[model samples]
Structure formats: C-alpha cells, structure tokens
Target: MAEVRGRDTWTEELASLIEDSGVRYGGDSPPTSFEVHAPQSESGESLKEQALGFVMAWCEILMELGRGFRDILRQNLINEDSYVVRKFGGPCSKVSKRLRFLNDFLPEDRDPFHAWSVVFFVFILALAAISVDPNREAVAPVVKVRQHPPSASRVLLPDGRYMAYHEQGVLADTARFSLVAPHSFLSSRLAGLPGVKASLLEEYGIRLVTYDLPGFGESDPHPNRNLNSSAMDVLHLVNAVNVTDKFWILCHSSGCIHAWASLRYIPEKIAGAAMLAPMINPYDPHMTKEEMKRTWEKWLPRRKMMYSLARRFPKLLSFFYRKSFLPEQHDEIDKLLSVSPGKKDKLVTEEPEFEEFWQRDVEESVRQGNIRPFIEEAVLQVSNWGFDIKELHVQKKCQTRGILLWLKSMYSQAGCELAGFLGLKHIWQGLDDRVVPPSMMEYIERVLPEAVIHKLPNEGHFSYFYLCDQCHRQIFTTLFGTPQGPVERQEETATAFEEEDKEEVLQVPV
Candidate 1:
C-alpha cells in the first residue's frame, strides 16, 4: 500500500507540472500522463508474447474457416439435396445408383483445385524466400579496403595518369607487327593471351602489348573516362611504347569494346582487328528479331537483368559490384558476371592452371580496390559507344550530308573520300560460348559483311581463349600468314659507314 501511494504521488506531481507549463505558455493542455504497457508472455518476454498473439490470431481465423469447410463436407456427404448434389452429382448418382465406392480408400476429402492451389502458393512462397535478396536494400559494404601502392610496370599517359602495362614477344624496334591486346572485365595486363609462349610470338615477329584499363591493376584512375578517352589512352600507350606504324588490335570477350572504339576514333592508327568471342551491345537497336532472340536466349535471365541494369540504371551497378568484386572474399567469376558457362567453359575454368592464373589476374585487376573504374567499364560495355560496328565497314562518305556536298563532290576531288576502316577484321567465335553467343558474331557479320568469321566447334568462351596453345597458334596463323621470325633490323648507320668505307675494308684485307 505504501509503494502504490508513492507511485501515485509521483504521477500526480508530473501531471501537475505539465498542466502548469501548458497554462503558463498559453498552449493547449498536454496529456497529463501516458502508460507504456508492454504486453508480456507467461515467460515475461515480449517477443514470445508477439509470437503467441500471432499464432492465436491466425488459429482463430483458420478455425472459423475450418468449421465452414467441415459443414460443407458434412452437407456433401449426408445431405442429398445440396446445391452441388442436385446439380452435377445427380446424374452421376443416377448412373451409379447400383454401384458402390471402395470404403478402403478415404472418402474424397481434398478438392483437387484447392489442394493444387495450396501447393502452388507454398511453392511460390518458398521461391520468394530463396530469390528475394536482402542485399538489394543494402547500400554499402561492411569491410572496406585501404589504399595500396601499385604493383605492375607503369607508363605515363597524356592525362598525367600512370597506365600499367606488360610487354611480351620481341622488342618494339624488332617487331615485324605490333598487336595491342586489351583484356576483358576483371582482368589486368598480366592476362595477355594466357599460355601464349614467348617463342610463338618471336616466331611470328609480333610484339604483343597488353595494358590495364584506367583505374584497374596498378594504374591511376581516370576521373571521367569513356569510350573516346579509352581510345585516346590506347593511342597514347602505343605512341609511348614507340609503335610508329599502324598496329593490330586484338580483343577477347568484353575487351573488344576498346578495339571497336579504336576502330571508330583512330582508324588510321589501327591496321586490323582480331576478336575472339567478341561481345556486342545487348540493347543495340539494329538487332533483328531472330538475332535478338538467339542472342538473348543464350544467356541466363540474371545476365539479362544485369545488362538491363547496367544500361538503364548504371548507378545501381556500384551496389552489385561492391557485393561481388569490391570485397576481399568475392564470388566466383560466373556468379560475379552472371554467366552460365557451357561444358567446355566449365572444363577450362576448372583447370588447376586456369584457377591459379585467374586468381592472380583477378587480384591484379582489383588491386586498387576502387569501384568507380569498374562501374565505368560496365557502363561502357552496354551504353552508347558513340559509333556502330557498321561504321567500321569500308564505305565512301562526303564532308557533309546534303546536296551542297554532293554538288561539290561532282567537281572537287576533296569533297568526298573513303571514310570507313579499310582493314580486315578477323572474328573467331566459339560456337558453344554462353557468355557471348554466336548470334552476336552473326550480327557483327551482318553489319560488317567484310569481316571474316571463323567458327570453333565444341569450344567455349574461355576454352579457346584462356590457355590453349594450339588455339593460340591457330589464331596467330590465321591473323598473320606464316611465322616470319623477328625483324632483321639492319643498322642504318653501320651499313652506311660500311658502304662509304669499302676502300678501308679492302686495304685492311690486303
């Protein structure tokens, strides 16, 4: 009784104080007091109380429903003049008046439609529980990466950024031909044509140059990089590396976007393009019905969704990329890329050598551990490339599009000129590739009819490109006719001196 009186006194004092304050301020009177009642279970826990309430509420409702069902069942079994019995059941009963149902089996207790509906609902609920990712609502990662220094051979670009690069085969001056190979997504300069031996390159006299994309590997990040900037970067790289003559652009998978950009912006600098399992824009407007169907059907639904997200809502890409690749513990390549690999691709990925190389290459790729560069790369793959593949086809174009240009073209030789890239394009497509479907190759062939397509049977996206020396040799032979060996760089100064001093040579011999 004393404790209750003390509590009541405290409540009264609080109420009086609140009333006095409200009156002093000339405001509306506040609530004198409020009670916070925490409904508790028998065990004195609120959560258990909530669970009990929830179960009881559902049970109460279901019990009523169950009663109604029971009444209906009883009517159907006992009442002969029920609505359903008088309708369809009458004729059946009349025809089977003399017949009897087997009592061994339970009477029809379950309605087929209702039972199936319950099963379907349960199935959908289970799928919803599985498919609905909670991370979709998540914004950031828990574990963040700290800054780390570069770990690759670097070059200074015009943009004042260091580009990481790797040189294979012969020296630049001794190179008969230069091949600039840009790596695919989640790869670095270290990924330059895996399993391609130095002897093979020397035999062909080809200088194979591979470089990291901006912000990838040990390279400095570009603030506002795009396709045009990508082409400019490659141009600067080749010039920096002393590639004076036009060079071939080699590509694999998504890396072909850079090659396409080079062909569009700096066609004069590019001699040819060799693409293996090249990726095309999924949202390209020029795709025909059959092409779109065949191309889209080859990919899993998740990949299509990812493409749509990258193309339409690129801002959302950071979230997904952060979840997959930005962290130290990342998803598998297929899961990260949302690719459904075919059998050959699975075999290639499962190889011990492929795993080792892929792990190292991926580490080098995400060395900087910055997500913006990856976001930029993903956006570049699906967004407008500023030029179409058909534009690379050799064709004549006027300085202007109208009749003034045409009228001038009839008189002036400079009014019109050959506009498109005149170089040959060699595309090697794996027929069983799931990442980049063969239909994309078909589309490329359709647009640029001059591009020759070589089909690889039973090969996958990675099988032919990853670590197959035979495939590499075949690709080399197809692009470059025969192994010509390294260039015999005749020393111009030495030759000139020898020619001018033949008398000295003759006197010394005597």
Candidate 2:
C-alpha cells in the first residue's frame, strides 16, 4: 500500500509542475504567468545584472533536473523499472561501483584511506635520516679520493717537488732518437702515444719518456705553477732520465702548451717538435672572424658556455669540478669536455682495450682528488703566454737598440744570426677532429708558415694517433725516415740513465 501511494504521489506532482510550466505533449502556448522578453539596448544592463540573470536561468534548469531525478528515485522505491533503476541493476553494476570508488580515492582535500600521508611522511623522514658522508665542511687541501698506491717512478726536483714518469721502447743509452712527451690534460706518464707498441718503438730505436704534470698521478703539486715552471719540469725530467743528445718534444691537444713553453724557454735543449691536433689559445686576439666562427661552431653550446666560464669566471669552476669529476664522474667524458667525437674516434673509444686504458689513466690523473691543478691548466690555456707562435719560425733578425748604435751599424755591419727554432717542425692534423678545428691549423699556418702540416683526410683526433700500429709505423717512418736498430752503448754520450738515480743537482736553470 505504501509503494502504490508513493508512485501515485510522484505522478501527481510531476503533472502539476509540467502544467504550471505550460509544456504539454501538443507544444501548447505557455500560461499568462510565463513571459518572454528580449534584452533592450536602452536597458544598458551592467555586468552584475547580466551575471545574476545567468545564475537565475541555471537555477531553474537545475530545479527541473532535480525534480526528474527525485521522481526516478520514487520509482526505484516502488520497484517501477525506471531507466535509472535498470542502469543501477545492469550487468556492469560492479564495474560502475569500482569506477565510482576510484574517482573518490586520493582526493587533494579529503581521503577515506586514512593512510595516504603515511608514505609521504615516511619518505620525508627517510630522506632526512640518510647521510652517506657526514663531513661536508671543506678546508684547503681536501682530497676528493683516497690516496692511491704508487705505480709510477718518481723524480725529486730542485724545488723539493716529486715528478712521476714512465719510460718505454729501447734503452736510453742505446737509443738513436729520444722523445720527451709531456702528456695532455687529464692524462699521466702511462699515455705515450697510447697504441704504439713496444716492439715498433724498438724498431725505430726511439726512447719515449712521458711524465705526469704537477698535482696529477703520483707527482707532487707545485705551488704557484705556470707554463714556465711546466717547461722547467720537463727540463728537470730529461736531465733526470739522462738523454745524452738533443731530444725531440711531442705534443697533442692542449698539452701542447707545456711543449710550447719548452720550445720558448729552453729552445736550445729541443732537437725538433711533432704536434698532433695541437690546440692553441682559442681566445687569441690574432684570430680572424672566419677562423673564430669555424672554431667555435664545432663545439656544443654547453661546451662553449663552459669555455666562456673558464675564460672569464674561473673561480666558480671549483663548485662544478667538485660535483662532476671529483665525485666519480666516469660517464660521457667527451660530452663533459664539450667535444663531439668523429666516427673513427667513437670506434676507438668503444674498444675494450681503449676503454680500460682510458679509465685507468683517468684514475691516475685525478688520483690526488684535487681540483686546483685542473683549474690552473684551464687558465693557462687562455692566459697570456710569454712568447708568440710567430717567434718559432726560422728567420734572421739584425736590430740596433739605440740611435747611436743604428748610426754605427750604417758605418759597419752588425752580427746577425738565426733568431727562431732552427729544428724541424711537423704537425699532423685530423680533418674530422671536432675538439681542435681545422681553422686552428689555418691559424698556425698563417702565423708560422714554416710548419709542415700533414692533413689526414678521414682521420680523427684519437684514431690516427692512438694505439694504431700501422699509423705508428707511418709516424715513425715520416719523422725518423727508415728504421735503424739501437746504437751501441759505447757510442752513446747522454747522461747516465740509472734506475737508482732519482735526483739531479740544479746545475743550470732552464
């Protein structure tokens, strides 16, 4: 009886509302109480009045919807099989329930789970509790890594500093050619033209010497070090190793700065020089617009930004170095350096042998875990060098200082001799090298016209020079001509190269 009464009551209320609203099955005219009015221009309705009208219209529509829904609910109570009742009891009723439940979960304001904050609060607490390294406070001489076991030979300099060095090829006393190679940035004594084998070096009768720079590998750090000090260190190393004859200097990439110093300060000690993809000051004032454009374009934007920072704002580098290199930054080495490797370079770096050698060398380079040495090296690359590249050309200069001396020179000829490096200068360039652009070679040729430039059409920085035996043979043959066996020990006149001799007396300054 109650269900029948409820259905009858809902039907009567719906019929009365529809009649009052003047809507019927025949589309009959609305009642006198209902009126239609168009908005008038003269009325000039304000923004607030227009907003009120919109709100009133929405309220009427919502009231109608509410009535419809209420009638449907009454039908459900009476088991009247309405559309809403059919949907509620549909086959997918469980799926609908799941959807509604999910929609209510993890809401921003209110949650029924009562456990959402548990994970978040626990995460925050765990993060606060974790501390891998408790000591963050740093002072002078903060070692970034544990001290490594000594693996290289050490030499004590006059300045009470120790230098680490490695020797390869034939015995120094029986060598026809002695090459003193100062390694490039992020390298140590173990990097002697990397891929060139021991037997090949023997066939050429070449004694190769490579050494770690200050604050690198097993070498002691030099206080207030510069390029001049760098050259002097090489000079001290050679004297320590006992190269009886004038030795050649080999340079690659930015490491050429040290060799350039050797050429400038101790020109008399060097026999000749061989440079491969040698880098000069990118910020050199002598660079032409075209040269600058080509050189700077090869680097990625990040690399360029880093170089700019190193050039202008060097003090900020420590913060970056600490985060990257000091904290075991082993991945994407070339990317960090802002260099894009060529196809050949990529192939070489991917090899297991090359990868192993490179990782070990890097370990030795940052073994001390200090950043100052790296900073100084970066600054030196762009800083003012004492001499110019033009000074290296073989030319004669006869100059009189004073007016009187000039007048006297008119009456009598003055003594004039060769003014620059008289020895041979050979440069090997890889065309596809991205680190040192081909424009750099152009600049070198423009300034020092006498330098021999050997262009490798398809070679890259590492591919042509590093660990390739055929390439090594070609380089040796080009430099020394046909290979000859080691010279007799009696014929050698170089200083004694004994393993026990670690210290050399500071006889003559470089």
Candidate 3:
C-alpha cells in the first residue's frame, strides 16, 4: 500500500488505491484466519500460509512507504496533519498499526518468521525517520547542464568576484528554471581562462553579481509564487550583493521581462538597460481568446503539438528544446511567452527547477486535501495571472489584443513618461527567425524611437552568445563616458522586491 501511494503522483488515485486495499484486507482477515484451521490437504495448508505471507509482506511494504513519505513531507516542512490526519485517517492508522503488529512477528520464537522481513522492517522505519528530518538546510550543488558549441570557444572568467560574463544559452544546470550562468560556455576547455573577469574590470569596470530567479538556478522554488513577486526577488538580490551603485542591466529573451519590469518600476536606479531579443507584446489587452486563437492560428498547427509533446516527455526532449533556440534568437521565446505587455519572450522551458518547485506544490496540495482539480486549476491560474497583468486598467471592452494594449499603456504610463525617460542608448540585437517576430521589435521601436536597433542577419534566437565580443565592445563604449553612479542601497526588510527608485510625478493641468 505504501508502495502504491509512493508510485502515483496524484493524491486521489493513491487515496483510492489505499481505500480499496484496506477494505479487501479488512474483509478477508477473519476468513483467512478461519481457513488456517482447515483439515484439508497439506497443499491447501501451504497455499494458506503463502497467502498470509503475501498479505503480510504487502502490509509491511505499505507501512514503510507511508513512513518514508511522512518523513519527506515533514523534512520539506509540509504539514502532514493538513491532509493525512484530517482527510485520510484510516489508511495512515492502518499502516502504523500493521507495522507495530509486524514488529512482534519478527521474533524467531514466533512462528520462526524470515530474518529478512525483520531486517527490512527495521531498515524502512529507520530510513523513514532519517529522511523525514534530513537536514532542512541542505542546498543542492550547482551543475552546468548545457551550453552552445561556439560559446565553448570563448574564455571563461574566474568565480571569486562579481564579474560580467555572458552565457551561451544552453540549459546547463538543473538547479532552477532558467538560470543563465555567469560565464559557463559550451566548452569546459575554455572556462579555465579569466576572460569574463578581464572583460568586466577592464572593458566596463563592472563587478559581476549572478542570481537565480525563484524557479531557476540557485534560488529556492515557489511553485505558486506570483511572477510580479518573483521579479521583485531579482531586484532584492542586487542589494544582497552589496552593489550600492546604479548598475547596467542586460537580459536575453525571457529574462528581459523581469529586467524591463524592474527598470519600469525603478527607473532612477538603473544607469541603462540593454535588452537583447527582448520580449514585448504588440497586441492589445482586450483581444478575446478567439482573437488570440486566430492570431496564433498560423503557428497553432505546430505549437500545440510541440507543447503537448514537451509536457508529456519533458526529460527526453529538453535537449532538443534548447537546440531549437537559434544562435540569434536566444531572447525570442522570452518575447513570445510575455503575455504581459512589454513582457515578451517568456518561455516556460527556462525554468529547470520547475520539478523541484512542483514537488513542493504537490506536497502542499496533498496536505491540504484539495489535490485533484487544484493542480489543473493552478496551471490555468498561473497563465491568467500573468495575462491579466498585461491588460490592467483598460476601460475598453477586452479583446485578447486590446487587453494587452491596455496593460501596456497602464504599465508604461505609470513609469518615467518623460521624453528622455527610456534614454538608455540601447543597441538592440534581434534575429528575425526566432520565436519573437520581427514585428514586435518594430513596434517597440515605434514607441521608443531613440533605441538603437541592430539586426543580426542569418542568425536565429541565441546568436548573442557567439557575438559576445561585439556586444562587449558596444557596452564598453557606453560605460566609458558614463560616470559610475553611487550604488543605492535598501533594507532587506520584506521579501517584497520594491524598486529602489520610486519617483512620483506631479501632473499639471494645461
């Protein structure tokens, strides 16, 4: 029974299995005992003993699994009383009692039971206890799981100080959803050199501070955590790194969402922001689902199938998924998934830590006993929350596109709305073939005409990693004349990611 529960991901199915198993065992126990007194053939006696042994073994395994599960839950800080104690009581009690009963059966004097059963019983119980309280503070080692081939040729920077370096957008680590490493390239061979360090100190005089978004990299996973809150966490990290001065911001693809959103809310603290293949929505917020369907209809034929397969076989297809990002279109998907206006390129695949995050989510939902439809509803809620933010404050009837437009207007107007507000001297690089359509960039250019747009021909989405040297040169030029500003520090008060610079604008009547 414990094995049955542990094997299934859903709570309902596991609960049902436990229920049925308990009922069968409960009803059959007396009959089985009565049959033990049969004066039948020796074969019948042997069969009865075998059946009893099977029942006992099954019960023992169930008890161990239950114990192990309980340990995992408690260690993970999941309150088991929320679900098991209140909702699923019978099974839990049965498992505990059976294990206790089995303890007495372990003695050699009692029917000469097998020594292995006793050994396993002791091992499982001990393991359950150990696993339940296994150091709550344990941190997983960071590993690089993927990198681009050409990026393998670039020299890697040292790890001691905060230095700026680019990652060749390969899914290298399984730590978080979309953790772009500081200087991890495709090649382990090139990482030995202090190339990234030299570039940061010499070329830009900037220190490198790396971070993992909530569901990615070195950060803890919060499956139900809101995106706005998660984005704020990135800003909080800036203070934690002791960088007390305004720093240049650069982001690729989906990362641009948080980067841009940060700049929008806290424009004064940002010296400049450079978005490579940044994700921005061109659609209006009010567009209907049908309209979105119509807009995506062209890609729907392929995208739906891809989404289905990716969901079904996440582990097997993760490699191919990374490969799909072209050299020039690294930031393309970020823009595509940016359902929020100005938040394009938001790809779900960037979150390698999703599984760990979801494990916590599952544990919590199970504990709450609101497991069955909650998982399905949670996915939709995640989608809608991000989508709704993009269309905030639109009085017009909401269409899918209109909704996004309304959100864009509200979000953009709230920030620095001055003429030179977005004057970052940005050198934008975009690939036409990537997930973000060329049209999205054109739209942003229309709004912020001052941004310098550089289109990389013949490259797909992720080509920026290969063009690091050129990007570095452009950034170096921008940093040389711009005097370094004093770092603005903030208190580590709330996990709330408040913008460092929150300037209020006074609107005057004409």
Candidate 4:
C-alpha cells in the first residue's frame, strides 16, 4: 500500500503533461492512461524568463547550423571535379568516353559532354541556391537597438530655499518632466532619486526634471508657502524650461502632496505621476505629543532659528545659534529640516554635513531680502494646516491613469498611506520595515480593501532604488499599458532570489 501510494503521487504529477502534449509512442499514439511527464520543476520562477531563454538559445543553434552548412558547401564545390574524376575517369575504356562528361571536366571549358552541360549546370545552380541563400536567411540577425542622447538637467528651486530637482527618464528625447525629491536626512539621499531616474532612462527611454525643495538644497530656507506655492515651484521650472504641455511628474516621499496640490492648480499640465513612499499627510497624526516633541528636538536645529530671528538679533542670535545650539543638533536637525511639505518625499539616510551649505544659503537669502519670514511661514503652514491635516490621508484617483504607491520601511499607516487612490491596481508596500511597524501597514491594508499589495521583505526606508525598478515597470505599464516583466522575488528566498538582476533603481526604498 505504501509503495502504491508513492507511485500514485508521481502519476498524478504527470497528468497535466499528458493532457498538454497528447502522449505519443513508437509509430502510434498512446492510450489515455499513458503518463507523459512535463519538464522538471526547478525554482519557482515565472515562466517568462524560461520562455525567452529558450527562444534565444534556439536562435543561437540555427545560427550555428547556418554557418556549418556554408562551410560544407564551400568544401563540396572545391572537391566536386576531383571527386567525379577519381570515381569515373580511371583507365577503363569499356566504361565509354562519355564517362569523361561525368568526370574531370568543367561545364563549358572541358565540355565533358556537350549536350548534357545545360543539365549539369542547372543542377549545380540549384544546389548552390538551396544551400547558401536559404540557410543565410534562416540565421539573419533580427534585433536592433538605437541610442538617443538625453539633454537632462538638475534644477534648483528657490521657493523652499534650495531644493534639488532634475528631469529624466523620457521616452522621446523631446519629452520633459518635473521630479520632486522626498524628505530625508541627506541632500544626497534626495539627489539619489535623480540618479535612479537617470539610470532607468538608460534602460528604458523616459525623460524627467527635478530639484530640491526649500531648505533642502541650494535654495533659501523655505519661508511659509501654501501647497499651491510649493507646487508652483514646478510650474516655475516648466516656465524656465519653456515647456507648455502636460508633463509627467515623479514625486517621492512628501513630494506626493505637492504633486497632488499641482493637480488642482496645474491639472491640465500633468501627464502622469509616480508617488514613492508617499506620506498622505506630512504631519504624522499617530505620533503622541512626546513623539512630536522628540521629533522636533531631534530634527530642528538652532542655526535655523538664527536665520529666523537674525534680523532683529542678527549678530547675537547668529553667533549663538551658529556657534552653539545649532552645532549641537546639526546632523539630526538637517534630516528633519529637509523634510518636504507634501506627500511621497524621499527617504531618510546618512547625510553629509549640511551646516556649511545651509549657512551659505542662509547668508545669501539674508543678502537678497528677508528669506527668514518666508522660511518661518512655510514652517508654520506645514505645522498647522487646516482640517486636522495630521489625521487625513491623501488618496489617489484618475479615470484613466497610471499610479505606483511604494511604501517605505517607516511607512506604517497602510490604509491611510494610500487611501486616496481608490482605483489603483499596482500598489507595493515594504513589509519588513524597521521604521514603520507592520501593524500599521496591516491596518492600512484593511482600509484599502481593494488595492493589490506587494510585500517587500528585505527592504527599508532608504531602499528606494530597490523598489524603484518595480515602480518603473508599473509606471510605464500604466502610462502606455506595457506588460510587466516578471514579479520581483522576496529577499533571502533561497529558491530564486539570487538569480534576479539587482539593478537597484536610483530611488531604492529603504
């Protein structure tokens, strides 16, 4: 019984193979019971890779066969006269003088047989035609690629002080875009997205534009600016670039909100948008008072206050903030201070020292005018937006649109994170985020009942590049309805993870 059970299991596994292949045998078809086996199951990979590889290998074999056939024909031609002569023109008069026609004689010159030359010439012509041309046709190269240079630029936004932005990943070299950076600890982290966008364009043609937000890069400290002004920075860039049509928008981290804000002010100008690690609201409603205070104390620097109060107490305050308090909170403060005001800003990561950069910009703004009030107002607006801004989650929508909502390690509130995108199909959220708790994601999922969720296991807040590859495909698919390559595998999965090409998107989600 035990042996029979094992045999039955193997036979059952072969059933589908028999059905698909119509099991055959020597000179006859098999009975219904004949068990044909399918190809062995290896790792749990999608069928796409296997199919492409098979086709590629088969084409290679055909190429080889064509080369081999050409070599055989060349040799056969060179030896043809000699072979015929050796076989038939030996000293044997009884064989008849006509044998010379089939032996060592070229068609016209030797005239082995005057009457039969036409037939022999026709036969040779047919053999050469059949051997060379058809084989060459079978192996002719088919695939071709063309290169187009990108006229991309990274722009600086003045509204929020000095935020970094650039345009990239354009299909035609002519298409342009406005890409916004996410909030994070380092300017480089914000710049990372542009780098990824550039790389993605290299493989898949797409064009975009980007810059840092106020207080993030070379810009002045972002004074108080409403969502409209924040979004208008992009429009201002479009004016600078002199583009007048609907352009694609790539928003990361808190930038999503600004992108959304643009929809109201510049709706007709937007082609599509990609929101990665987007925070529905910049203010985290879930945080307790203690948490908010801690976040502020950890992120806001004294030097920033010096810029704010520098006018009334310029010498004294700048000295104190720059020399003492600001230096103390410099590193962590830079991270928090760089946060973007809208949804889907970039992720936080190790940053270079920002004191020199910030101070230079602060001094420049001070020389230009009172950039402090603008900076202060921007902070106040972000701190206290109307309608319980912290509690409200931004959702996504469009009658016909493409959306990619990539959650980061710190993104805990799931349903609220993307509750706005009611009809979005391609939704991917990192599962093993050390920053945002899994419970938060679960709750978010419950709220977004219909959205498909992709759980990224070995990722974190800064793994933007890792997540960006999937987002890249999803974006192209949405805008052009292109098919996805293959599902990304979970990390550390022994089965097939090692084989996947780890071309981290420039904005690998942490």
RMSD, candidate 4, Å: 37.5
- Worst ten in a row by lDDT for model 1: 98-107
Ranked candidates, highest lDDT first: 1, 2, 4, 3
Q: Tens-digit lDDT track for model 1 on 236-331?
A: 999999999999999999999998999999999999999999888877889999999998888887778678778766787787788678766534
Which lDDT values do the candidates have, in the order given? 0.82, 0.79, 0.41, 0.44
List model 3 lDDT by residue over 1-510, tens digit each: 665554443544644775533322223122243222334585588799999999999999999999999898786544655565566667767756644544553655654245656677997897578557655224433222232222211111121222122332212221111212111111111221113334343323344344433322222334454545534554555544434556566565544555555555555556666666665432434444554444344343344444433334334334333443222122222322222222111222243443233222222212222222222222322143353223211123332256766677665654323333343636455443344545555555655566677776654444443324555555445545542321221123222254322222234334
Q: Tell me the lDDT of model 3 at 360.
A: 28
Segments in model 3 whose C-alpha atoms lie over 4 Å from true places: 1-197, 281-427, 478-510
Q: Give each prediction's root-mean-square deviation over alpha carbons.
A: 20.9, 21.3, 25.2, 37.5
Instruction: Mark the regions of model 4 whose C-alpha exceeds 4 Å error after superposition.
Output: 1-165, 169-173, 176-194, 197-199, 220-223, 263-265, 282-382, 386-427, 434-454, 466-510
Looking at candidate 4, what is the lDDT of residue 134?
53
Model 4: how far is 423 from its true place, Å? 9.0
Better of 1 and 4 by lDDT: 1
Positional deviation of residue 99's Cα in model 1 after best superposition, in angstroms: 60
The C-alpha TM-scores of every prediction are 0.68, 0.67, 0.37, 0.38
- Per-candidate clashes come to 0, 2, 70, 77
- The sequence of per-residue lDDT tens digits that candidate 4 reaches over residues 168-251 is 444332343333333322232234343254554543434445554554443444545666676677677776665666666555
Ordered from best to worst TM-score, the candidate numbers read 1, 2, 4, 3
How far in Å is the alpha carbon of 257 misplaced in model 2? 0.8
